[model samples]
Target: MSDNMFEFAFNPGEEVVIKIKAPDLKNKMGGETLQHLMGAKREMLLALRSLLDDAIARTDAADSPAEKTHIDIE
Candidate 1:
């Protein structure tokens, strides 16, 4: 993955709240809207895969050997 593919950001000293107003049903086209969202989700999955590849490469280079491994769920 290329660095230009996606971006991440943080707020230095504050939190933000966002609200979205969905399109009014009278103005919506069902099949078209569903197709658009499906395409967006596909792109999101591609982006996530790229990010994971980058992170794994960095971690493999930096980590020290340990005796045991563990997994946890949130």
Candidate 2:
């Protein structure tokens, strides 16, 4: 719950977290601090958008006879 990091639990046993700290990411990507900060935000937004869209599609397709699935790849 810190200011620079965020943790999200998508399901009871599933988890998804996203942390973006610009100062800590200095010189990591090919850009300045501010640029990297903004880029990270944009990328994160796009990723979340895609995830939400997929969730919506699945929800609307609840009538489909798809069995529960789990993939474990380590």
- Alpha carbon lDDT of each predicted model: 0.60, 0.69
> Clashing residue pairs, candidate 1?
none
TM-score of each: 0.43, 0.51
lDDT value for model 2: 0.69
lDDT of 1 by residue, 8-62 (tens): 4558797543223333333454687767865765787777689779989989877
lDDT of 2 by residue, 20-74 (tens): 4434554554557668677877898788789889999988899678789999999
| Best model per TM-score | 2
What is the Cα-based lDDT of residue 19 in candidate 1? Answer: 29
Off by over 4 Å in 1: 1-9, 12-29, 64-74
